[model samples]
Target chain A: MSLLEKISDQATTLTPGERRLVENVIDSPTSAALGTAGELARAAGVHEATASRLAKKLGFVSYAAFRDALRDEFIATRETATRFEKTIAESTSDTILGELAREETQALGRIEEFITPEQISEAAQILMRARRIFVYGYGNAEVLALLMVKRFRRFGKDTHQLGTDPRGLAEQMLGLDSDDAVLSFAFRRPPRGYAALMETAKEVGARTVMIAGKSGALLTPRPDRLLAAPRSGDQDAFQTLTVPMTICNAIVIAAGLTAKEESLKKLDRLGQLIERFE
Target chain B: MSLLEKISDQATTLTPGERRLVENVIDSPTSAALGTAGELARAAGVHEATASRLAKKLGFVSYAAFRDALRDEFIATRETATRFEKTIAESTSDTILGELAREETQALGRIEEFITPEQISEAAQILMRARRIFVYGYGNAEVLALLMVKRFRRFGKDTHQLGTDPRGLAEQMLGLDSDDAVLSFAFRRPPRGYAALMETAKEVGARTVMIAGKSGALLTPRPDRLLAAPRSGDQDAFQTLTVPMTICNAIVIAAGLTAKEESLKKLDRLGQLIERFE
Candidate 1:
C-alpha cells in the first residue's frame, strides 16, 4: 500500500499530534518525501516525536525509513510529463474535446463525495460574518481570487485581492484584523507567500478558509476550514479549475442564501447602477 | 413560439446578412430589445436593411415590432431576484452543494453539443501560430484571462493580459498587429471597452477568438471565431464558470498537443526553474 493508504488504515489509533503529522504526509507527500521529519512536524504543528511515532505506527523502522518509502512513491507518481504523454496516446485530435468533457463531468460528479455540505455552510458563514475579506491566489489560481473578489463585492462585502509581492502582501495583511477573513486558493504546490499569509492570519486572529486541491491538506497550521479535492485525474495530470470553481459557486450561493434579503437588495442596487452607467 | 425558437426554426432560410442579425438577436436578446434596429444591424456587422428583412422573415411587420416583443420577453425572464428566490426555495443549506454540483455537471455535459472539436482545433492553431497573444477579460472574465495567460506562457508563447483602463488599454492596443491574436471572454453584458477592443483588433488585422456566455452572441462586428454556451438554468439564474473554464481547458490542452515537443521542453524548463527558485 502507499504511505497515504497506510496512514488511513491506522487513523483511529493515532494520537492527535500523530494525526496532524499524518495529515501533512497525505496532503503533500511531495514535501514529506523531500523534507526532514522535523520539517514535517513543524508544518503539521506537532512535535517531531509525533512524526517518528507515526512512522512506527505505520510499520516503518524509523522516520527516515518512512520518508524513504514516501520518496520512492513520489518519484513513481510524480511523472507529469508521462501522464500527458499517456493522455495524448489515448486521445486523438478528434476525441480530445469529448474526452476532456467526460473527465470534467466525472470530476464535478465526485465533488460531493469529497466535500461535505457542512463544510460549504461553515465557509459561507465565515464569509458572511467577516468585516472585510481578503482573497489570495497565485499563478493560475489568481483567476479564482479575482472571481471571489467580484462575487463578494457584488453582495456589498468589502473584498480585496492579496498581492504576491512581499511588501504589498505585508501591507494588505497589516490592514487585516480579527474581524476580517482570508479565503485562499492553493493547488499542487503552495504559493510563495502561503505560509506567511496563514501565519499572519493566525497571529491576528482572523478567520481563514482554504479551497485546495488534494495536496492542500498539508498546509501548515491548517486553516479554520479546508475544502480539498482532486481535479479529475491523478496528481500528475494537467489539472483544470472545475472542482475548485464549483466549490466557490456553492459557497457564494450558500452565503447569498444565508444573507438573502441583504444580498438581493445589494444585487438590485448593482442592477440599477449598471443601468444608469452602461 | 419564442422569437429565438422561430429564428432557429428558419435558420437555413436566412440570407448571410439576415443571418448575422438573427445571430445578434439570439445571442443578446437584451441588447436587441434595448437598442434600436440600426444599432442591432451595426452590432451584427450587417446593414440596417438586413435587420428589417430578418424581422419580416420571422413574420414580424417591422424590426421595431419584433424588438417590442423581445422587450416583453426580456422583462418576463430577467427577474434576477426571482431566480434566486426560486433556487433558494428549492434548496436548503443541506442540499445546496449537491444541487449546484448537478447543475454544473449538466452544464459541462452539454458543452460538446455547443462547442465543436473543429472550433477547439482552430482556436488552438491560432494560439500556436500567433506572434503574441493578448487575453481580454473584464470583471469576472479577468480571471479566465489570467488563467489563459498562465497556461499559454507555460507553453513558451509570448502572452499578455489586456488591462481595462482606457489609456492603458489604448496603449496596449497600439502594440497589436496582424501577427497577434486577442482572446476575450464576455458574458451577460459586454464591458465598456469591448467595442473598441474588437474594432481595434479588426482595424489592425489581428486574429480574434471570443469565448462568451449566451449574451455574447450580439458582440458588435463579432469576433473572428466565437464559442458561446449557456450556464445551466435560465439566463437570470446565477451562472458558474464551469462551461467557459472547460472550454479554456480544451483549448489549452489541444494547443499543447499540437506543439508537443516544444511545449514539453518548456514545461521541463519551468519545472527546473521552480525547483531552483521555489
Candidate 2:
C-alpha cells in the first residue's frame, strides 16, 4: 500500500499525539525535517520523544527515516500542491511564467489537500440519483463550471450550466427538490445573489454542493455540503487562482467513477441527444 | 541551462539528417530506442548510416547512449505530468473526474506539443505596449475574456472583457486602433454575432489575437494574433477542453511581467479608485 493509504488506515488507531505528529509532518514536512527535534516538536505541539516515536510507529527505523518518508510523501504530493500554506507562500513571483507556474502548481496543491475519496463517492451517488443537475459558474469560474457540465452530462446525468441570470438561478433554486442537486463553482465570496439562491435551494430541499473559500455564513444554509477551499484572491480580478478549481476537478472526476450503472445508461442516452444537437 | 536549452542550441547547427534524427528521438524516445537502425532510419525517412553517424557524432559511444539521452529528455518532460496525472487518472471512475481529466490532459498535451516561446513573447509584447486592450470571449470563452480584464487591469492596463452583448462589445471596439489591440478567444465556431464584432474590431484597425481551434477561415473575423488549440469535446458534450484558456493564463502572466513598470503604476491608481468605490 502507498504510505498515504497506510497513514489514513492507521489514523483512527493512533493516539492524539500520533495524529498531530502525522498531520503536522504531512502539512509542513520541510520545516520539521530541517529543524531540530525539540524545535520541530514544539512547533508541532508534541513532545520530542513523541515525534521520534511517531516516526518508528510509521515504520521508520529512526527519526531520520520518518523524515525521509515525509520527504517522499512531500515529493509525491507536490504534483498538486497539497498544502494550503505552502501554496500561498509559493504564489509570489516576478515573471509571467513565474506567476503561471505558481498558479498551476497551487492548483495541484489544492486538489490533493481538498478532495476526498468519500466526497467523490457521495457526490457521484448524488449526481447519479438526481433527476436533473444544474451547474452554475460565472465570471472566471465558468470554464470549470462548464467542464463539470460536460462531464456529468457524459454519464447521462440531466445536467446544464445556465446561471446567466441571478433571479433565474433563485427561481430555479425555489423549484428544486431533494431529487435534484446543484454543483456550483464560486470562490472567495460568490455574488450576493448566490447566497440567496443557495438558501432557497436548501429551503426547497435540494441537495446543493459548492466549491468555495472560507466564508461560513454563505454556507450556513447547507453547511453539510460545502466544499471549502483555502481563500485566495487578487483584488479587482474576477478570476480566482486555479488551485481551488483543480480541487473541484478532482472531486468531479471521483464522483463520475463511483456513480451507479443506471446513471451511466442515462448518460449514454444524453450523449446521444447531444450528438443530435450537434 | 536545462536539457531542452542544450538540445535546442544544438538543434540549430545540426544538418537535415542529424536534425531529423534528433527531432524524431526527442519526439518519441521509447519507440526510437528499441527499433533497429534500419527501422529507425526508415521511421525518420533517412539512410541507415545517417542515423548511426548522427548518433556517434552526438558523442554517444553506441546507439544506446543516444537513445538514453533522448529518453532522459522525454522523462524530464513527463516528470511534470507525474505530479498530477496518476491521481487524476485514478479518479476517472463514473464521476465527473474522468471527463475533466481526459479534457484538461488533452488540452495541456496539445499546449506542450504546439505552443512556441515566440507566440508567448509576442502576446506579451502586444499587451505591454497597447494603447488600449479590449478582451473578447463568447459563450465558453467569455470566462477567460473577463479574467484578462481583471489581471491586465491589476497591472494598470486599460483592459475590458464583457461580451454578453455583441452590440456593447462592438461599440466598445469602435475606439480601437492600430495602436490598440483587441485580445479575443473563441473555440470551435461561435455565433455570427461574435464574428461580426471581430470584423468591426478589424474595420477599426484594432490588432487582434485569438485562442481558438479549426484555424483561419474556420473562425471568422479571425484575429491577427492566434493562439490555436485542438477542438476536442469531452464525453460528446459541447464543452471546450480549456487548452486555450490555460494558454490565455500564460499570456496574461507573461504580459504582466513584461509590462511590470506600467502595471505597477496602474495598480496604484486602481487601488485608489477601488478604495473610493469601497
Candidate 3:
C-alpha cells in the first residue's frame, strides 16, 4: 500500500501527536519528504521521537524510509502532470480543447482560497444595506464595475456608474454621503484622477471599497475595504484580471444569498419585464 | 490496497480495452460508477463482456461490487469536499484571506488550456509585424484596449485606443488599412457602436481579432480571429470576466516572448526615460 493509504488506515489508532504528523504529510507530502524528520515533526507540532515512532507504526523501518516513500509519491504526481502536458502538446485538437477545460476547472478550484463564503457575505451585507452604491472602474476594471452595477440594480439597489470623463466625475460624486458605499476597481496603474475620486468619496462620508493589486494597500488615504488581488508575474509584464473578477462573482453570489427574499422579488420583477419586452 | 491503487498496479498486465476502462474510471469515477455495464463498455470502446471481466480481475466478485467500490470512492471525495467547505465555513480571517490566493492560482492554471503556447506565438507574431495596431474596447473593454496599447507601446509598436464617442471613433478608424491589425474585446452587451467600429475596421482592410464570450461567434460580420472565453454562471446572473482577461494575458505574454530582444530594448529605453524624468 502507498504510505498515504497506510496513514489513512492507521489514522483512527494514532495518538494526537502522531495524528498531527499524518495531517502534515497528507497536506504537503513534498515538504515532508524534502525536510528532515526533526523538521517535519517540528512543523507538525510534535516531537522528533514521536515522528520516528509514528513511521514505525505505519510499517516503515525508519523515518527516512517513510520520507523516501513520500518523495516517490511526490515525484509520481509531477510525472503525471508532465505527461498530461505532453499528451496535449503532441495531440489532436480534441486534446487541445480538453486542456482548456482542465485549466479552467482547476482555476475554479484554486479560487476557493482567494474568495470565501464569509468575504462574500460581508461584501454582500455592505451592498445590501447601503443607501446608494456607486461602482467605478476605468480601463479594464470598467467592465467589472459595469457588471456590479447591473447585478446590484437587479436586486433593487440604486446603483450608479462613474463615466470615463474626468470633468463630469465631480458632479457625480456630489450626492454620495455617509449612507452610501463606493466600490471601485483600482487595479494596477490606476488612472491619474482615481485618488482624487476616492478622496472625494471619503470626504462625503461614504464607505470606499477598493479591488486592487498588492500595492494598493500602500496608496495614500487607504480605502475602507481593500480586496487585494496580487499580480502574478514580473512587474511591467502581463498581469491577470481573473482574480478580481472571481471576487466580483463571490460578492454577487453572497449578496443574493444574504438577501434571498428581496433579491428574488427583484429578479422575479425583472424576469417579467424581460418577458413582456420579448 | 485501495481499488484505484490496485488498478494502477495491474495496469501493465491489463489488455488495451481493459486499460481504456480503467482510464475512464480513474478520470471520472462519479460518472463511471453511475453508468451501466453496457454504457461503460460503449464509453470505453469495448465489449460488455470485457467490462465485466475487467471488474472481476480488479478482485470484484461481480461488476456490481466494482461499481459499489467506485460509488464509495465518489462519496468519499464529496465528503472531503464537504469537509473543505466546513473548514472554510468555520475558518478565521486569515484562512479567508488565503482563499483569494488559492482561487487566483487555480484560474491561472485553467487559463493554460483556453490559450495554447502556439496560439500565443501566432497572435504575438501578428501584433509584432503589423504596420499599425488599433486596440478597441468601450465600457469595461476600454481598459483591455488601453492595457494592450500600453504594452505594445513599450515594445515600440504604433498602437492606438479608440475613444468612447461615436464621432471621434469614426475619425480614429479613417487611417486604418490592410497593413494594420485591430484587437478588440467584444464582451457581452458590447457598446452601442461596437459592430459599426468592427465593420469600419474590416472595410478599411484591417485584420480584426476579438476576445469575446461564446455567443460572440454570432456577432454580425465575423472577425478574422475570434478567441472565445465561455461565461461561468447563469445567462444574466453575474457573468465572469476572468477567462477573457486571462486570454489578454496570454496575448501579451506571447508577444513579449516572441519579440524578446526588441521588447527588452524598448523597456530599457522606457526605464531610462522614467529615471531621467524623476
Candidate 4:
C-alpha cells in the first residue's frame, strides 16, 4: 500500500497527534513528502519525535523513507490521472450521469481501502451507550446532523440537533457530560464555532465523533474519534457528499443491527403510537 | 438494451406520463411485468394506452414482450444475491467498513444506469434562471434541500430554504410566479406538507423539480421535471445517501460549468469580502 493509504488503514489505531500527521500528509502529499521532519511536525502541531514515531509505525525506517514512499505513490497515481477528469473530457449529457455515478462509486470503494471497519463499529458503540447524543452540522452539514438525530430517535434514543443557532449550540455543548456523546459533521468550509463546540465537549469529557472530509486536517484539536470520508472529484468541478453520507448510513445501520432486539421493540412502539395518533 | 435500461438511457427525453410509467416499472419490475397493462397503468396513475405506448417506445411489439424481457433480466440478476446481505452475514469490525463502502459505490453505479446527464444539466439551468429558487426537503430529504440552498447561494443565486416552516412555507409559496422555481427533495416517508407544497407551486405556474427515490410513485402529482436517484442496499439495512448526494454534486457542477464566467466573478467577490471582513 502507499504511505497515505497505509496511514488511513490504521487510522483508528493511531493516536490523535499521529492522526494529525496523517491528515497533514494527505492534505498535500507533495509538500509533506519533500519537507523536513521538523517542518512536517510543526504543520501538524506535533513534536518531531511524534512525527518520527508515526513514520516508524507505518513501517518506515526513518521519516525520509516515509517521504520516499509518498513520492513514489504520488508519481504512480499522477501518471494515470483521476478517472473523473477523463470522464469530464469525454462525457456528453447522455453519458455524464453514468460517469458521475461511477466516479462516486469508485470514491466509496477507495475509502474502503483506507478506513477500517473497526472504526465504524467503535463509533456506533459510542453512540449507542451515550446517555444522550448531541448532533450538529453547520451550514450544509446541518442536514446531516438532523438525519442522525432522526435515525437515533427512531430507536428511542434521546437525541437533539443544534439548529441554526450559535448561542443555542454553545449552551447545548456546555451541558454535555461524560455520559453524553457529540457527533458532528464538519465538512469543507465548516461553519464557525466548530472549534468552540468541540472544545466544550472536551472540557466536559464527552465522547466526540467527527465525520469530516480531507480538510479535517484544519480542525486544530481533533475529535476523540474521527471517521474520515475523503471527498472526491476535481476541486474546480464539484464536491461529492457520497462518502460522508455513506459513512453515516453504515454507522446507523451497524448500530441498528447490533441492537436489533431493542431497536425492533422501540420501532414497534413507535408504530403503535403513529397508528393511534395519526 | 433491455426494456428498463432503454427507459433509463432515454431518461431526458421521456414525457412526464411516460416517465411515471418507467418509475412504476423500475419500482417493482416483477409486478409491472406480471400484471396486465391496465394494472400497471393504474399503479402509475396513467391511462392503459400510455402503458402500451411506453412498451412500444422501448422497442417492444407488445407489453407482454416488455414483461418477458423484464422477467429474463430479473432472473439473471437474482441468481446472485445483494453484496450487502453477504457482507452483513460475514462482517467483522475489520471487514464491515470496506463492505459498506463497496455497497454504496455500487449504489451510485446503479443510479447511473437510470438518471441521465441531460436531466442534471436541465435542473442546473432551472436554478440558474429562476427569479427565486425555493428549496424544500421532507423528513430525511431536508438535508438535500439545505445542501442545494448552500450551493446555489455560494454561486450568488437568489435562493431560499423553507426550513421546518409550514406557516412560512404556505406564505412563501403564495408569492411565487412563473419566474420562480421550486425544488423539493422528497424521499421515503415524506413529510405531510409535501403534496400541499407541490400543489401551491403548480397553482402559481412556477417550474417544479423533484429530487426523489423510486418510491416517487407515492408523490400525488409529480413535478414538472423529475431527477430520480434510486436507493441502494438491502431494504432492512441502512439507506445510503450517496446516490442523491452524487446527483446533487453533478447538478451543481453542471450549473457552474454552464455559467462559468458569472460564477467565478461571484466567487471572487465573495473571497474578497471574506478576506476584508471576517
All candidates' TM-scores?
A: 0.62, 0.52, 0.53, 0.60
Q: Candidate 4: misplaced stretches above 4 Å?
A: A1-96, A163-166, A188-191, A215-218, A234-237, A261-278, B1-94, B163-168, B189-191, B215-218, B235-238, B261-278
Candidate 1 chain A lowest-lDDT run of ten: A76-85
| Per-candidate DockQ vs. reference | 0.13, 0.05, 0.05, 0.13
Provide a comma-separated list of chain B TM-scores, one per candidate: 0.61, 0.62, 0.55, 0.60
lDDT per residue as tens, model 1, A1-278: 87778878898998889888887777666557656789999999988888888899899999888987875564222232234224422333345556666666666655544455556767988998999999999877888888889888887899999998988998989888999999998887788798899999999999999999865544565778888766765455466788898888778876766665333223233234322322
Docking class of 1: incorrect
As a whole number from 0 to 100, the lDDT of residue A24 in candidate 2 is: 58
- The residue-by-residue lDDT of candidate 2 on B68-135, one tens digit each, is 56544432232444443444444434434344434454345334323343455577678768888887
User: What is the docking quality class of candidate 2?
Assistant: incorrect
lDDT of 4 by residue, B95-185 (tens): 4456666566555545543344446667878887898999988666777877888888877788998866788778877778989998887
Per-residue lDDT of model 4, residues A1-278, tens digit only:
43433654565688999978876665445456445789889999999999999989988898888877764543212122223231233222124455555566556656765566678878988898899999988766776887788888876789998755878777767678989998988766666777888888888899988898877757767898888767655433345567787788668766765655343323223223322322
- The lDDT-based order of candidates, best leading, equals 1, 4, 3, 2
- Cα RMSD of all models vs. native, in order, equals 26.2, 21.2, 18.5, 23.8
TM-score of 4: 0.60
Candidate 1, B1-278: lDDT as tens digits? 54544554575677889877765564445456656778989999988888888888888898778886775443222131134432332222125655665676666666776788789889999888999999998877888898899888887899999999988999999999999999999888887698899999999899999999877778887999998977754465466778898888778876866765333333323234323322
Tens digits of per-residue lDDT for model 3 on A1-278?
88778988998899999999988877766557556789989999889999999989999999888877875565223233334334333433332223333443343333332233444555667787899999888866766787788678767889999886887777888888999998888755665568788799778788877776644544555666665544433234334455576677657655655554333223233233332322
Q: Count steric clashes of candidate 4.
A: 1
What's the CA error at residue A175 for candidate 1, in Å?
2.3
i-RMS, every candidate? 18.4, 15.0, 14.0, 16.4
Query: Model 4 misses residue A124 by how many Å?
Result: 1.2
